[model samples]
Target chain A: MTLKKATAYRLSDNSKALLIFYFVIFAVMLSFILRTTLFTSSNYGTLGGLDASSMIFIFVVSLIFAESFKMLQQNGCSRKTIFLSFVYSTIILAVVMAVVDSLTAMLMDIITSNYESGFFQIYQARYQSMRSAQHFFEGLLWYVTAYVMMGAIGFFITNLYYRMGKLLKVLVSVGVPVFFVIILPILSNLTGGAIYEGIKNFFDFAWGFSHGFNPYFSMVSASIFSVILGGLAFLLIRRAVPKQ
Target chain B: MKGIEIRNLSKSYGEVVALKDINLKFGGDKIYGLLGRNGAGKTTLLNIISNRLFPDSGEVLVDGETAIENDSAQRKIYMMGESNFYPEGMTIRQAFRWSQRFYPSFDRNLALSLVEKFSLGLDKKMKSLSTGYNSIFKAIVALATKVPYTLLDEPVLGLDANHRDLLYKSLLESYQEHPRTIVISTHLIDEVANIIEDIVIIDQGEILRNQSSEEMLKQGYTVYGTAAAIDNYIADKEVIGFDNLGGLKTAYILGEVDNIIPPELEVTKLNLQKLFVVLTNRRALK
Candidate 1:
């Protein structure tokens, strides 16, 4: 269905309510940034001082809304229809988040730059990492991408729960991540950290690309990983037979 | 006008055969009572026909098209079985909303009316509702969907007697208003006997009986009298089952007893419930 006709809630009012609920929660964090005194137009191109907690807030909101994606599959909505709508909405929501984040960061940068000019000048002399302020820009891009990926993970798990029975589903949902978190350290120790270093280098490049300070190769590497992982998710939805 | 046709359809769960080389056809605007004992494969057959599950062998056809994952064929049929797949935290209204989205023919107004009539609160979360209320909510969803071929597996399992009677009455009213094909797989035989026009009795992974209820009723009757007299009266007929207490005996015979039943024998009519039980029980022993 085309986006114009694809009102997610049209099929059921409950679906509509869910979509709205998700949108509102997502918008709330942006509202906080908008209301902050540091927000200004002059610093639009810079990363301000929003901490990881706020970023995580947006991610959590995205995850909650992703529940509707599973609901669509459960209700026998076609694979193509549900997937496309999900992607469309995700993109739309991401775009909105990007705009809000940029505005908030710019305002904070302008306010902070003006308020503590002397302090920054003195601090800049002693600061070693300010050598890569350009990386900050790339970091913003990484933020949006990571949040969307996190949302995708939530969506995938919900779909998995829908397809598998209780015991297997619970095991897979909890086991896979718990296994990775626990085993990664031991694997790093045994492999002399080749696997660990490779993963770290990958995310470092991703961080560089988001801040617009990374080498062109780093951006390409991040893009490749994003495309491969995102494509796998799309395939999962495509091949999904209505599993109840 | 056409019906679901199954040919050599078989399904197994590990070592047990759920359905064994089953073949049958159901057609037209008739209410079919899919009577079977608990593991007789009633749900499996219905699921396969509705494209909810896959079969290991053979093919099921709806209007001459394969039913496995056929969207158009599935669109013509709706299966509301025992499993209620409504997600956690969804309210009754929310369930209706999602149903309306996926099912093009779903009637929101009708669903709302049923919700009110059943005394189900729209705001009540599905998980919070009692089992009977949950079943009622699903029944409303099925009725409002208004698909041509509606399959309800154990439609009123947890319902109280009054609610069950109300559901039966509403079902008849709905069916009359939109005379479509309805396949009701229910354990409550007597409750649905009067409304069901056709019957398909499944037993031990096979179809024991598939016939018009009228014909089945005519063929199945109970001959009551003294143990010796009832046996003598039904000697020429096929006896599905017999019960004797003290010297009084009642034998459930298959086929008509028009002129042959002795004057001394008391014959009472067999409804769908008795016919289904005897047929299913006999097939089980065999």
Candidate 2:
């Protein structure tokens, strides 16, 4: 409907602002990573380092952007429209970040490698020393995986916000996740190494797209989980009765 | 005939029943005053009719087509809910834009005209606006949507007397230009008495009274005289309510007063506000 489009456009304005904000923050962080030896091309000399940082970065940005999606729905925009709009915004943000990060990484790689080689070759050769095709596909999968999961989390939060009792709406909006954050680490510690290792391994595998670590399977698993969780969340939000 | 027909509708939130076995039909080119006391399911019923909520049983038909999840039916009905559902950061202009997108019939020019008429600042953020202004913004949207079946639940909430009057005028003007089924649920019966064609009094989730305003008025009469005289006249009659001051008394009695009351008694049209107070009070007592 026209209203849905209007809602989406209004929301996209805010989304665009947030996207820019994240872009600036990550760009600055990329500058810092360039100056640090830990992230340099010479260090580790594998796709693992770049993949890890990119996946983590994508995940964190997705989490923050989830807030923007929630704002869209809260603003009298329908949940279904918001869900649909989010897919587009997420992809847009992903593409923007991919371009910006790659450009910055390429520039930094050129300068650093050129200085190390003692040759002022125009458009430094090592700058074009890209990861294998497998790694590129893995990175793409990881990006989509993280974003979809975050979008699902966004829907989940919206559902929880509606399901909460009147008094709990405001409190739970911030409090529930905070409570979980405080509990999860303690629970992991108490549960010991096997559980901790499993959790760590899961994240590692989920983010391990650059090493040809079964990108399709990891993404498919994440997508399935996301769909199931997102569906439940949609149901909850849809049937929520506004309480006095 | 172009109106809403809700049959055997039931809704409950947990153990609290909002509506039960509700059957109602609201016709076109008419203004219906959906009067009810608080928690009497007026909002709940309106929500269901507008497709904001689902019923546990039965169906809501608009022109004989199920309204639930039916886009064509939903497109015809525009609802302004009691609660504030507008986003916080949006300005009046932005809200208008959003409404225009959702309702193809939404008249942006009309919305803008209302904005000007109301002297509302278009760029002021909703969160920054006063509660009254927030309601005004939504009222403007509802009026401008120009949908066939418009249901306004407490449309004048937080509005000042001047704006309320303006709203009534604008509503009447809009209806005259494009006649539709307009149902208003509000406590201000007297304020809307003149414009309301029909009245539906809901009490404790039951339809206590539903009839034409003229018919409803005709069914009851008010007698004013000395306390003793009024008391004597209504002694065996069904008195809806009575008010006494010193020796003066006014008693509203149900049914015709033509042959029952004394010829010396001063009989007059029952003020809808007073009649509602009496009927609802009587219903509550039962």
* Top model number, lDDT: 2
lDDT tens digits, residues B1-286, model 1? 2888899999998998999999998888889899898999999998778655678899988888877756566667777778666766788876776677667788899888888789999999967888798789878888888888888899997999989998988889889988888999988998888989998989878888888888889877877899888767776778878788999988888876677557788888875666777777666577
> Compared with the true structure, what per-residue lDDT tens digits does model 1 show for residues A152-228?
55455555455567899788878888879988888888999998898877666654533443334443554455466
Candidate 2: the clashing residue pairs are A2-B101, A2-B102, A3-B101, A3-B102, A75-B87
Determine which window of 10 residues in candidate 2 chain B has minimal summed lDDT.
B255-264
Q: In candidate 1, which residue ranges exceed 4 Å CA deviation?
A: A1-74, A78-86, A107-144, A157-195, A206-212, A215-227, A230-244, B60-67, B225-232, B235-237, B243-249, B258-260
DockQ for every model comes to 0.24, 0.21
lDDT (0-100) at residue B161 of candidate 1? 94
Worst 10 residues of 2 chain A by lDDT: A114-123
TM-scores, all candidates, are 0.76, 0.78
Candidate 2, residues A118-166, lDDT tens digits: the string is 1112112223353334434444544556556655665566566657667
Give the chain A TM-score for each candidate. 0.59, 0.55
